[model samples]
Target chain A: MAEVRVAVPPTARKGEVIEIKTLVSHPMDNGFLLDYGGRMIPRWIINRFEVEYNGEMVFSADWHVSISTNPYLIFYTVATETGQLDFKWYDDNGEIYTHTAEITVT
Target chain B: MTQKSTRRDVLKLAGAATAATVAPTIATAQSAGGVVVIGAGFGGATAARYLRRAGVSVTLVEQNSSFSTCPFSNTVLGGINNFSSITHGFGGLRREGVNVVRGRVNAVDPDAKSITLDGGDTIAYDRLIMSPGIDFKWDAIEGYDEAAAELMPHAWKAGSQTNILRRQLEAMPDGGVVAIAPPGNPFRCPPGPYERASLIAHYLKTEKPRSKVLILDAKDSFSKQGLFQAGWAELYGDLIEWVPFSEGGNVARVDPATNTIFTDFDEHKVDVANIIPPQRSNRLVDTAGLADGGDWCPINQTTFESTIHANIHVLGDASIAGRMPKSGFSANSQAKVCAAAVAALLAGNDPASPSFINTCYSLVAPDYGISVAAIYRIIEDGTIAPVAGAGGVSPSDAPASTRALEADYARGWYASITADMFG
Candidate 1:
């Protein structure tokens, strides 16, 4: 877990589709490159990222080694209630990163 | 086989007849609808990709293939990275179905909608997009030119010249002097040359303790100045010497054959000189009569359409995007807005007002980074202005955690921009 940036519109209409972009900062190392000692760094990477609104999953993605170090995900979600949008990323080792953003629905 | 005409056969025949009559006319119209794009860098590449995606054929003329990149060139100079790691293939553009031609453009005829290549091939275009990044004003420095670059490598365009400068730095004596001369404003990457200096200083402090790096800059302050200074103080204090223009560091000339750069009131000779020259729009824009003055192409900030030429759009470093620094991130941002406008105009829809964004990151060390971010909107009068309080630089006296986080943010910035442009 490194850094998380969440972009939620300041206001949205209820039940309207709104775009939200979340970018998380992590090495996402696939253990491919050789280290200074010429030994391979073990693969330790985030395998899945999910976004939830009020504890209900809205968007989820599975990533592979091909994804760059820091993964930025932009997607849309239907805004029904004014609540919190929680973003969580889980690594292969079960390390979880949680960040939250407050959104308002008119 | 068919004594009576079947419905399928009759429908097929009618469709074939219609296609036969319409196809030729459409083919002729499309062939005549040519596009000339200047500069084959990231901005040009994206525009070419999207235009091809939109079914508009393009002729992308670049002065060189295998463009070396300034983004990660510091790693090469520091001996931490190699050129192959940063090099990219144009085959991606080829796969996108673009005509990527390698040639220097001599002139542009906006009225005639024609471009003359260096080899005398005249190309006519219905629309022209100029993304030719930047060019140095040799006159800005009294004794600097292509010849002077032999020994004093700007390495700005990132190719063999970059390698030359890197090798020169590597081969210098442990105690030798390395001078980096950064140009004034309206240049590409306002924070880049400073970052390069910091990276070089990092290498010197670790590998050659006796060596020193001098940054002679033409500006009073720089992007991430506070953060970079703090890092330098913490990491390599007294190992790096920075002199702004007012302090007599402004470069006046260079005699590369003698390895000397003359400034007002003093002459500093060094073992290696990295001169980042003052820049303007690429030469093709000037040839096309699109340049207003000061090495920039003036365009309507709203649509990125050239004020000097009809049906021509200019984006990226080449355009005088007032208040927007010439950076890779800015270029990509401008490209997306331009793409939307082009798509709309082609679809017979009104071009929407465009908004641009920029976030520039610089590495002060391997794990330390700083950034400046801003969101801009086109004003009603066709000018671009930063949205008040939308984004700003990292705090000057940030904590260790913030600095470390900025390093990760820098990587994220790279990923985002590459995805927007090439992915």
Candidate 2:
């Protein structure tokens, strides 16, 4: 299980661009490193990240091994009739870390 | 990506200007019994804090509000630490009653006993302590200047350059050649380039196994050579190769346009190049005449006061302290001695004799660490000399557990030392 954090403004004016930021806690072990015992630590990383605004896909990113640990993403989207924003991160081991935030748009 | 471009642009500007000119601002006043310390890195910050603790009014002026240390910066390159983890602010010093000003010092007037900031504000001081650190000898390497630095980053200053090199490494393809050209002896952090080589090798091992690290050196020997080589062989095998000066390892010039390094005998077209050119004390030392027609400031060993100037002291990498390697730990130790001397002079008291200690820890891998430490004191010749039998390097034959323990201690050392300086 991974921990996720999301930042979406609680209120925004209609037709105004709003910014969203998120940070996900993951080691993102790229499978190339060795452990204390000198054995390989298999590749583990968040492969995809997606954002949903009011049940519609707004933005997404296809992440790779180069992404460092505790991945952070920030993007902008126009605020119209904001309600709930859902963030999802899909990892290599089939784990999906999710977070949701509520926003009000005038 | 924005962060990368911004950092690159900043380095480009720094390279373009001999003395970077910041926006002018109104100068502040310094009261009597005040001490102004330039540079807020390990040396200046420690001296300012200690001066404040000694009941002396202090002002610390620095161009950057935050400091990123060279120590453990290798961890950032190795992917073991984040840039933010090593970055620190001056909030702790403010709480200690030290006036922390954010600006670059443009001039030092020893006669007036005052220093001018970039914007033309001059602050008077009873005593001035400088720890401005190192500036590269750009002319030493043909075709290697600030613009070329944009392509082949030095990453020696530990903030933006550090990131640029790491990004280049990340963007490099597997099996690509990464070249690191270390300067001759007496540069900052004698073991720094080698530590960088080790950690960069660590990164490529896990992320790009086919890639290799190539070190083209200007010096035939380096600090902790035996220990670093032993660890390199044990962990990285032949992934890292070192070329000494005798073997034409000295980089004569670089062609950044082609990503190539030309030595006396061989020209290597590397995928990524880190050229750490020769270094001297910050240009301010030369401008202020504290270097006394030499590359480094000559200071009185007992007080760290410049022998050429009255009431002005030099500390850290800028000053020529006998037998002391240029290191963050050395600077921190020197700052204390200088601080005590400054405080005594301000109080009209003879300064007490001082002894210095330095312990430099270099991480070879995430779990493997090695160190060289020494205790120094003023000898009869008025120069600093290491106290024999007081310190030694890590044993070459240490076990895995011992190496791991030293690794843990290295992290602990970074945490505590930064705290002592910043606070």
Q: Candidate 2 at residue B415, lDDT?
A: 90
Residue-wise C-alpha lDDT for candidate 2, range B277-340, written one tens digit per residue = 9999999987579999889999998899999898899999999999899999999999999998
lDDT of 1 by residue, B11-121 (tens): 998787855644443343266675667776667767776666556677787877755556767767766678886676677677777888888888888778888888799
Model 2 stretches with alpha carbons more than 4 Å out: A1-106, B1-31
Model 1 lDDT per residue over A1-106, tens place: 4666566776899999987766566777788888899999888778888888999987899989988665656689998999999888888888898888888999
On the 0 to 100 scale, the lDDT of residue B54 in model 2 is 69
Per-model lDDT:
0.78, 0.89
Q: Model 1, chain A: how large is the TM-score? A: 0.89
Q: Per-residue lDDT for A33-90 in model 2, tens only?
A: 9999999999999999988889899999999889877676668998989698888899
